[model samples]
Target: MRQKDNGGHVRQEDGNVNNSPPPTLPNLPSRRTPNFPSDPLQILRPDSSESRRAQLSEPSRGRKGASLAAVAMTKPQQQSPPSTTATTTTSPPPPPSTPPPASSSSSLAKLPLRLHSLASSSRSLLAALRRSPVTTLVAAFFLLALFMYGEDVRTLAELSIDDYLYPDADFYNVSALPPLLLPPPTCDLSRGRWVFDNTSLPAYREKECTFLTKQVSCLANGRPDDLWQYWRWQPNNCSLPTFDARRFMEKMRGKRMMFVGDSLNRNQWESLVCLVQPILSKGRKKIVKRGSFNIFYAKEYRATLEFYWAPFLVESNSDNPNFHHIDQRIISPERIESHAKNWKDVDYLIFNTYIWWMNNEDIKVRRPNSTSWSEHDEMPRIETYGRVFKTWSTWLEQNVDPASTSVFFMTISPLHNSPAQWGNPNGIKCVKETLPVLNYTKPLDLNHDMRMYDLVAKVAKNMKNVPVSLIDITRMSDYRKDAHTSLYSIRQGKLLTPEQKADPQKYADCIHWCLPGVPDVWNQILYTRILSKSSPPSPHPPLPPQ
Candidate 1:
């Protein structure tokens, strides 16, 4: 019989050296014979799945020699000759014997193979990332920012899909944040400062030698007709034609207009109605508020003209007497959104909020959401106002759609209490000056007024699609120096005391315009802006109350 290779030592089969030895190793010098069980030679043959599993279980044995690891993993079919011989059927045995070559080790030796190289490179990258976390995170953030910048550019170039799908959508227009629209505004320091001096006043050659004084003796107890006639005589150059009660009634016959603001806003609204109500035969005009906040509907024009007195336009606690004066109580963006639902769906949206925000030391508005200012607060008034308006405009841009509605931001209605601007620093208290007169030697420095101008421009700039027009009544109205009700003296209608009649310019009501007075000029400008194309002669028959 041919000598059989015992299960005790390494066997050489057809030039292949396979290790399937007994416990004894020739390299070991210890010759003491310890009775050891015969090694299973068949285990190395890979003929049974159990043997193959057993072989993989010993990673150290599998990795003994570099060649053994390579042969065991690569060309496993050829290395495991017994298994190849055992499987005579078309399908080969599960040769999971080669543990599918672990992803880590084989990837090490076969560094030249693209798949292995890729795996190795990935591991190296992971290790490198672990070493420099900050740098990796910063690089990732930079890349993300670059991606967002590109996305913004794309958004500006085309209408976003969200725009069309949500027609009533109120998305803030980022473009409105820029100062681009300010330069193009028609009213500004240039026009406002241009005063009509003794020489420049001649621009108008009046029929009378009475040298049209921009100032006129003001009225007390309100004379509607005289107020109407006075403003027509001195219409601001930038403004539209003077108010014609008859004509305005006809023009606004069926139209609806609204003014929304605080008590001051109501002052103008009441002045406007009084001036025009006289033009209507008694029962033709009525003043009514139907589910309207501060709105006033006049009977003659059939116009539902009204005023909504939401100074901030956001709902907040009104119970606190100081709520109106406290800066901290001012509504925040999140708070404003809570009330945005009520402001929508209007033909023309007019907004004004200034005096309400004039919170100074000792006067603080404390909203549950906003913090009260302390001595440590250092923010500028303009900055605070800018931020507030920014939030407001952003919400406006997001909620209002220009396609169906028109938006307007009226320039802050100037208060006549500023003696320097009204040409009466000491004696005049806005009550004595009634008639239209040029009392100021120069145009008032409008730093306070320009804040509103700049804000409107800023809002217009950042807005997209919405053509927000500015009703710049500030500069236009600034020219009427004597128009204020100075010292409460009636000029054109009521009889006055000898003392009152003697100094007509001393007792003027400075705050409100003589409706049928200068404010009519503002309304005319508004009309020109809205109804210019048609320029319907002031509507006849007056608007009926709605």
Candidate 2:
């Protein structure tokens, strides 16, 4: 019979000379068993140093037999059979009395040298561990880390592009989870971290969207890195739903959605068009410029996404989205009908106006029938801003039907005008920033942005007729110092020149964000409101009714 010694190598034992049948053998691994990584030591126990050394030793008594393990796993597809002629011998197989066959001798001869070298290396490793424990530990750690990283790379290599863009599409049970478009009543949508996930982010690609204006197309304007496109917003307790453009369009089927306010609203309006455009058929979609509105129409669904240029949400001298960069700005706070007239019949209305009002401490207020700068009164910005919003609110209360039209007031979109605010003291503006700022020692509830945030919420709460949903994005926006268009955007209707990009302090366009970046996330929040048909809660408490 064939038997294994303490070292686990096979040797022939004595048997009946005349009547013995072919010796019974232990189960041996064959060509059918593929050993991955094809290393001889893989079969040994990882924690047993003695067994490792023993496996590398020659069989006892110079039996002419060997372990056959290394040769069994040498080739993945085909390996020559180990010599089995000794198994049928009548007496115990012994060392050859004369010179053996060349085939058998050469194969067995080279194995001992290989085993001797391995044994010597194993002893040296043990001696090193004993001599310098710390050095040996560090080397072992590095080797282990290398092995794990190689495995991760191998796993990632197997994924396809489809897997990258739609990973978790089927992971959530849609019917069981909260409304795909609505935040839970208690869920704090504003409290979240920006998660790095290359698989399913960016919401859309910069090159794919035909609706983008050059002002927000940072990637096309000589900016280099594309890593900014791979972030997903993860709330502290809940997750935003996976966006389904088809479903959103179906819900807004036969409806008109208008975004009314400043260029910031127009930025958001452009994002919505890009997101919903891919799902529309080529000839079925078209955009038109009509008066103060840029309208995107989905013919099959009969849906219109309209943007109206109303920068203070009331009559302002800068109301013209094009050619609104006047040296002096003026507003007629009470005269909002020229702007609100277009918004009265819309099914969904989203409004935002802040960055334009922040340029000067005092604003020029022109009363009715006053067009000249000579007839304007310079008032503190807060009072003028407050009265302008009040005019917007009063129009909402008396002009539109609450049951038919939904109103949403977007809070301030914070600015990254200073690069020093984020750790770059030598930097001039939002350039070369690829990640959102995350480590705030305290929550962002005490800045100038929050002051505007409180005022917007307080105004919305005071209204009794209109159920206005305040999309408070300011707190979350404070952390995104890296997402602005900076010098990639246009100034005075002209794309920034090389000289302007070089001088960020004078021409860095920090007022707006890059498309396929922050604005995409903003629309996801907007889509949530249209999805659930329920008002998303505001982060601030409403003031007491007087």
Candidate 3:
């Protein structure tokens, strides 16, 4: 018969215990049992009733066997009882002396539970991202675009304000900028003196140009004093800006500018061409003469500087540039359509007609119907000048578009035929005059008919539609008595003879100015006027699409 010990180990009725090892138990912290106090003498004693009760009440058979084996090993074998005295009653084994078997199995079971919890959290996160894909894509694209185009967006914003204020200045990197707050240029450009500075002499050489006339080529005709070329015009209240040839050419590019009037206008036209020619390369310019029109074309700039010979500013028989006699001057005062046809399309027109109208002879006027000339001596010089200018002004009002064209009338260039006009009793003419008259505090009395100037001013002022600016060059030119061609002028491509040269008072050309001289200053003033009145450049072309 088999009997169970209190430690759950099986024992024979003969009192011999079976010593087999117990089965392994699953590791679980909650199933672990507390360790009891160990005793060295417990193995020799019989099991108590409480131990027997615990062995019988153990839940799993495998766990009960493991616990019983641990207890048997820790307890020593008890002294065997006599067979006759051992009545059928079996003794229970003592409690375990080692740690409980559940302790090791409990720790092993905790790892799998922790691993299951982490996998459950990962699945929940993946489900949330899959629900909304469009929002995720839009956010990603916005960040990428900002990274690629950030600089370009910033540059466009900065240029928007800069381009509004300075429209044309975007292309060139100019070194100096004009003052933001500057007083408007006044009409008194002629109120200053001629200052002597060698550095400012001769804007261009006379021999370099093929269009230069011998009548005005004082340097080419061998004048003694070179100091006349160095004098610069300075206004009283403000300083005159220096002429920049490159800048002027840039302004005149693709434009047609004409000087319309007498040979005096030709003098100024040549002066302007020479002033700007040095900045252009060779073969870049050409001169074309067609009828009464003389054109200087700068090829690179596409600009034409032209002179049309209309000395009286009307249709006259003296319009023949080559062979017309000065005494036979007759004008059709009502008819200017012939000359205005060529002048209408020009961008800038500088009209001058003064010295040619100063003749005291009986003037001849051609009426529309009458074939015969009508002589008028009773009409004063001012009335005749006014009638002709009225015809010109009427033509301007009818034809010229003031928005597209700029019109200027150069005042009468003064003549220095009589030195007595400047209080010089001994000096009769402009000959032998080396310097400007400095001591004469009073204005020099001139033979130039001032009535013509008054007529021009009146016509320009009265015009309501057409705008005309009068470039008053008279007073400034009056002080330049030393700047004339004088006895040094070339007559018909020939130098004056010794006899003619001896009497300079008779042969002196006190009318036209020497080249690289006073006319250059006039052009400088013209340049200033052009700059002051000019509109800003057009807007920049639109940028290409990205």
Which run of 10 residues does model 2 get worst, by summed lDDT? 4-13
Of the pair 1 and 3, which is ahead by lDDT? 3
Candidates sorted on lDDT, descending:
3, 2, 1
Q: How would you order the candidates by TM-score, starting with the best?
A: 3, 2, 1
Q: What tens-digit string does per-residue lDDT give for candidate 3 at 371-396?
A: 65554223456666778888999999
Pairs with backbone N, CA or C atoms under 3 Å apart (clashes), candidate 3: 6-92, 6-93, 27-105, 27-106, 28-105, 28-106, 29-106, 43-76
Residue-level error in angstroms, candidate 1, position 501: 15
Residue-pair clash count for candidate 1: 81
Residue 221 alpha-carbon offset, candidate 3, angstroms: 1.0
User: How does model 1 score by TM-score?
Assistant: 0.46
lDDT of 1 by residue, 112-155 (tens): 35455478887887688789998679868977887967544443
Error of 1 at 172 (Å): 40
lDDT of each: 0.44, 0.65, 0.66
- TM-scores for all candidates? 0.46, 0.64, 0.64
Q: What is the alpha-carbon lDDT of model 3 when measured against the actual structure?
A: 0.66
Give one clash count per candidate, in the order shown.
81, 0, 8
Q: Which ten residues in a row have the lowest lDDT in candidate 3?
A: 4-13
